[model samples]
Target: MAAASIMPPHTNPPPPATARDPTATVSDPQRHRDAPTPSLRALFLRAVDPSRPSSWSTAVADLLSSGDPVAALAAFAAALRANPAALRPALPPALRAAAAATSLSAGRQLHLLALRSGLFPSDAYSASALLHMYYHCSRPLDARRAFDEIPAPNPVIVTAMASGCVRNNLVYTALSIFRSMVASDSAGVVDEAAALVALSASARVPDRGITGGIHALVSKIGLDGHTGLANTMLDAYAKGGGHDLGAARKLFDMMERDVVSWNTMIALYAQNGLSTEALGLYSKMLIVGGGVRCNAVTLSAVLLACAHAGAIQAGKRIHNQVVRMGLEDNVYVGTSVVDMYSKCGKVEMAWKAFQKIKGKNILSWSAMIAGYGMHGYGQEALHVFTDMRKSGLKPNYITFISVLAACSHAGLLNEGRYWYNTMKTEFGIEPGVEHYGCMVDLLGHAGCLDEAYDLIKEMKAKPDAALWGALLSACRIYKNVELAKISAERLFELDATNSGYYVLLSNIYAEAGRWKDVERTRVLVKTRGIEKPPGYSSVELKGKIHLFYVGDKSHPQYKEIYAYLEKLLERIQEAGYVPNTGSVLHDLDVEERESMLRIHSEKLAVAFALMNSVQGSVIHVIKNLRVCTDCHAAIKIITKLTGREIIVRDIKRFHHFKDGLCSCGDYW
Candidate 1:
């Protein structure tokens, strides 16, 4: 009863059992088991006395930090019992201990203890601590009530309130507080620390307006040049809604770049699918960044850029750095290497990197799964997933998405369906839009259009446009015009602004001889002012990126690239290769279509790589869109004729063309 009653109502283990001596500060079981032998009191006596509350609280803090929280809490209780008037001085440390222990009941009682002593509302130190404790215990509303009780909040209290609000997902409340601080900075609480908190809040809300205004305010206060503050703002821009990468880059160029500044910019470029730009920045960060040393985050971000850009050479360079820095076994660095190699069409390198990681986390497991999925190795991915489960780790939402995608890419329809159901029914991990998109893609790839449609209709959550768009893409592959129209109709209702859907539908129509529908769809683009993103291919060479659009001639070496491409085209044609002019989607004569197809972006990039690279070296080309049927056929023939392996990483997956056969088995 004493142990149960030691807590106010509901807390575990019961607060050191409230010993008979009132300053016992040791549980009965602990006392019985280890009496007279360095008891908590013996440790407490060296540094503190119960009647001296400050030192006693100091002992509590030291105990907690030294991995003896039970003893620390006991000492805290002993001090409280010895002197009620000392509660004011003791409250902050007690509140912090409560936060560390995540004990809501203990924190609530400390709030009561402060209130009973008539020492709270005005005690700014205790008030700030109470805000922290409440948030740590997942009680934001209580924190707000406590904050409102403070008659004159100071800078520390304001910072704690804003930070707590942000941490608790009350981001708008945090923003409002930040705005209030900005509007009335009589105390000048909008210091670098507080500004960092505000930037973090803006990052969560994804509102560019708020982020820009805060950036301006931070600049007006002359804190813009502060490296740490600048890093926070950079992160806000990257995560905050529309990633204005140009603005982030300009900010980066202006600031005296630190490792964090460089890392943030690199991550921003990677997040926005600007992998080539990311790799370039990583190079600049090392050479020209005033000798800013690369940390795990820095190398990890650059490795991700290398993965997406298929700059295996750059990736290998970073990998060598990882080895040199003795970070070969760091989970973060190792996982990035695994992910980098996996996406760059080097599965063996990925596995070696994965095996070297000492302690694998969910992210590491998921990366390997997605890597196998990318390479169309479904069975291998499942085996890795099984190993992950056996290692006492549970699969999360990302893990299941990777699993389903692996199955889909490998055409393991039954495995995909079973895993989809297993995720929901057994693991209780609800399938998100990405998971559902994987399922739709899988069914569509298998020509189970009706079943995919039925699955969408039966989903508990409403499908987004991307889900329907996945079906539409599958429709393009199979030329299922009726289902394509249905998916397109849903896509229009859900995401009418997306130009890709309209283009996809138009392509489907053109394939089915529905020229009228294709023309109408193309006209709608002009009427609605839809801007389609231009298709381009980029290949990295000698630490620089060369990008090509359809018939791009901006490169200084375009004359040579064009000549090489013409020769390759003539050779491929001689070897029984015929261009599929239907992919053009233009109502041009056959000759014109064939002529346009000859200069497609990937072909130009390939021609450039072939001209520049050593003979028989693998040419890695990254495209912004799907590889058309004609290019696919052309690349296959080119691979055979030249005896060169060409790896084209498109939007969906990797296509490793070697000896006239692709790794995707022509499924993609």
Candidate 2:
């Protein structure tokens, strides 16, 4: 913490005192005065003077100790001017100190000095320091230039350059250098540090082929046993977006489990939609006693798993643990908690968690806004967006996506359009596919089918399947068979293997009473061998998720659940609720269609939840598909009759039913 300079003792002498005399002193004596003190630059020059035999090393060291890289460089420059040969040996240390301070301009000046003295590039340590300084300053090109100047660089120098490239996001260049190093046996075997850096770059680039190659190299070099290297490789495989979970798991299983290892695996599972496995691994981690305790990362990953699986009870328990560990204030953990509660249909809890997050950044604010949007609280989402701007957090691309989605869900067409325009004109964020999709959905939901189609046509980027799907969905809602067919054709061409689009088209046909077209669509689906995945719903109770598919009777308590559902159905009928058989989209008789509607997955899950959960507790169900119109209406009646809040999170947004009303206001 010392300053980079200290004035030499006696360099600036104090003024001499004049002796006072009696009335006759003026004629008797005259006083001599000391010379004026020298400036700091003059003292520094004197310290560097060769004739005076001063140590420029001592002066440079004292200047470095001042903790100011700029001042240190100035002293070093002065020393070099006075006695170039004496200070040439001290250039590397001065450059290193400047690099450490991240003073790029000063470091560059020292680098120039090294170059002038012919001590750079030929001097491996100096070259590495310059490379590091360039990386710190985000000057990758300069770093590359420094690296290229090295003649026959050693492994340490090569590793430093490669690591710098990775740190500067020059992954392809890093990989190239790494490959050259590996190919040169004369350059020495690739060390653990180089391999780790290569693997990190591979993961960021998401080159699974390179990742595999690195893995093989590591294994061949016997560095696989190193715990940190193994963890990095595991992360590489997990995040490479390849379907090689087996490889990631194998590596994870073989490694000595650290807190990071566990977190990596849990986060991988959560990200890949294997939420059940994620929660199970979390449980295993808790049960196994060791030095590996859960940290903010572990809690965040597991909370994401809870959100995905709709494991509310488990999420609550994890939230309590977050509080106990005092990690609730950690931004990532806090954001995860908000996202978890929001996705799990607990908007109130999500808001509470959002409120407690100190130093909320754009990500935290976006999470809260998205949580409100997902729960169909469009106005609240917009209000939060306003507050975020007022708090001086600029809305990024992701923030705008969330805001537009909220407007879409709440049928705020004008608000959606205004923001969509403002996002580009004011915020300078070009509308990406997600923003376009939200806008299409907003328009489609508002019955502006032609406008939605025109917008798709005018998109800067090619419209993707999701955009077409939104249009098709809108067509179905408004019973526009012609547009629905057009949308379905585009969607099917893009994603031909997905049977859901075909089913949607058939549904649209059936709604229009075009039996022949429905038959043709069914034949096309069969011809393509595309099977629609069966829908299922899950309800988490007592930290365990219970799944129920349509017509499912596999649960241990299925009989009780069925009997309760039957009685509840009768009561709902008595309460003047009639079955809407049109949702079946089949040629069966009305009675048979009604029977099918009764066994819908969501209803089954709701029945089981009611049978097992305590009275007055909220029922949360996660569905694999969008809720049907019949189910939506039925749930409203069920909530009114049972006098309990029921939250159903389908593929789209949430539906919170209480007293014959839903949060989506019957629009979604």
- lDDT digits (tens) for residues 417-441 of candidate 2: 9999999999899999999999999
Cα RMSDs, all models? 5.3, 9.8
Q: Candidate 2 — worst ten consecutive residues by lDDT sum?
A: 31-40
Per-residue lDDT value at 413 in model 1? 97
TM-scores of the models, in the given order?
Answer: 0.87, 0.80
Q: What is the lDDT of residue 394 in candidate 2?
A: 95
- Give the per-residue lDDT of model 1 (tens digit) for 296-345: 99899989888877888888999999999999899999999999998777
In candidate 2, list every pair of residues with a backbone clash: 2-66, 3-66, 4-63, 4-66
For candidate 1, what is the TM-score?
0.87
After TM-score superposition, the amount by which residue 236's alpha carbon in candidate 1 deviates from its true location, in angstroms, is 3.9
- The candidate that wins on TM-score is 1
TM-score for candidate 2, please give it: 0.80
Off by over 4 Å in 1: 1-51, 63-75, 78-86, 100-102, 183-188, 204-226, 237-258, 288-291, 588-598
